[model samples]
Target: MRNVSINQLDDTPRKVVALGTDYSHGHLLPFHTHRRAQLLYGATGVMQVRTSDGNWVVPPQRAVWIPPGVAHEVLMLGVSTRSLYIEPGAVDLGQRCQVISVSPLMRHLLMEAVAAPLMYDRVGRDGALFDLLLHELTRSEVLPLHIPMPAEGKLLSLCQTFLNKPNAHQSPQYWAEQIHISLRTFNRLFRQQTGLSFRQWRQQACVVLALARLAEGEAVTRIALDFGYESPAAFSTMFRRVLGQAPSVWLEAAK
Candidate 1:
């Protein structure tokens, strides 16, 4: 689905432009760039965004702040999204994409902003609402919901393979053997290429893949088993450790 409607979006002369749109399950947006920074949040379901820098997953109650001029594509996992387009320099949300948590109040504000006129008054109640929205965005807490891929072709290929079938049971030694490298050399290369140790990267890959599977209506038990977790509790512990909530609870919030 063409949810963002960039053709209809006119960011000029407006500090903040909001749009509320829905996407069907598995909808994909081709790589594109926006002149304005985008705060793309899902009211329900999950969003997977891939940029040159890394891949980010935005779950429910969270949003990804994509800087202006960055080429990115989003895969909507059955989500209804609320998007805010801010003119370049209107907000200093850094120079890269980062996932940020959304407060209950901020969620309400976004809904209200999208319902307001395209060109909201800058001196009236609408102006104050948008102002508050911007403030909340600036203070939003960043979340660890990204997986960085290595630039090296060999390492990138290996990383992509692991991401496709992430399993918690795999050890660094196993991965090193898969790449036909000594354990010591594998450790050095992984750090140099991905900026993360093999263990760290595996866990991150598992978490990222877990988010996608959960969004597709898979049960936590099945997902845990698929990811090589010994038990549902073990999987929930890892999920909670990374996301600060159990998988079931997180899925409930997304709904």
Candidate 2:
């Protein structure tokens, strides 16, 4: 659908509108906002979503909740998506965007919702399906797949660079000096802007990026060495520390 048509549907009285779309690897949607909140589910591949507030990664069978009017952009990594444009006030999702798990039932509901009439009978099967969809959304589990970016331009740039070549071994002093700030001030500002300490942020970034590489069939040992870990065991330990599961188990769940 065209951007203008999408904007027109923002406040429909129907309460919910489901749209299905697909993109090839590396497709990018530039920064944009919608009048309605969105649940963007990736049925086949991963998505990297970025807003000024932070960055989030959504892998296959996962989704992201974007509150109404929040400007964001999405990059598709071989994705097929089912997106729900929910009228404002239809659900009670908080303001920030978050990555959420998609249950098997939720997956089927989304496929059904998109195939039904756009203005299905209020008391009919389509309406019932959407009601169930909303209920399931309320109970969906939030995933630790977000990497919050700092607001400051220089620091945010530094963080972005680190994401391209994430190294968990990088010291606080190294990062602080790269940004030309004292270690104490850097630590304070980093937490102030991103709500995470430097070390915590780095680990989260690595984990999210690691998910993409793992999906692409990269060996765990290569990923470990590329990301500066001493060994695959070390990488597994760090991944478990942040995600509560070993890499293999986590990838299986994501698959």
Q: Which one is best on TM-score? A: 2
Across 150-214, the per-residue lDDT of candidate 1 in tens digits comes to 87676788777877777788787887798798999989998887788877777777787888788
Tens digits of per-residue lDDT, candidate 2, 1-255, equal 212256555555799888888788999999999888999998888899999988888878899999999999999999888889988898977999999989999999998887877667879888999999999999999989899987878898899899888987998899899978899999999999889899999899999999888877789999999999999999999999998999899879877
TM-score of each: 0.92, 0.93
Regions of candidate 1 where Cα sits further than 4 Å from its true position: 1-4
Off by more than 4 A, model 2:
1-12
| Model 2 lDDT on a 0 to 1 scale | 0.88
After TM-score superposition, the amount by which residue 13's alpha carbon in candidate 1 deviates from its true location, in angstroms, is 0.6
Query: RMSD of candidate 2 to the true fold?
Result: 2.1
Give residue 94's lDDT in candidate 2 (0 to 100).
Answer: 93
- Provide the clashing-pair count of each candidate structure: 0, 0
Give me candidate 2's TM-score against the actual structure: 0.93
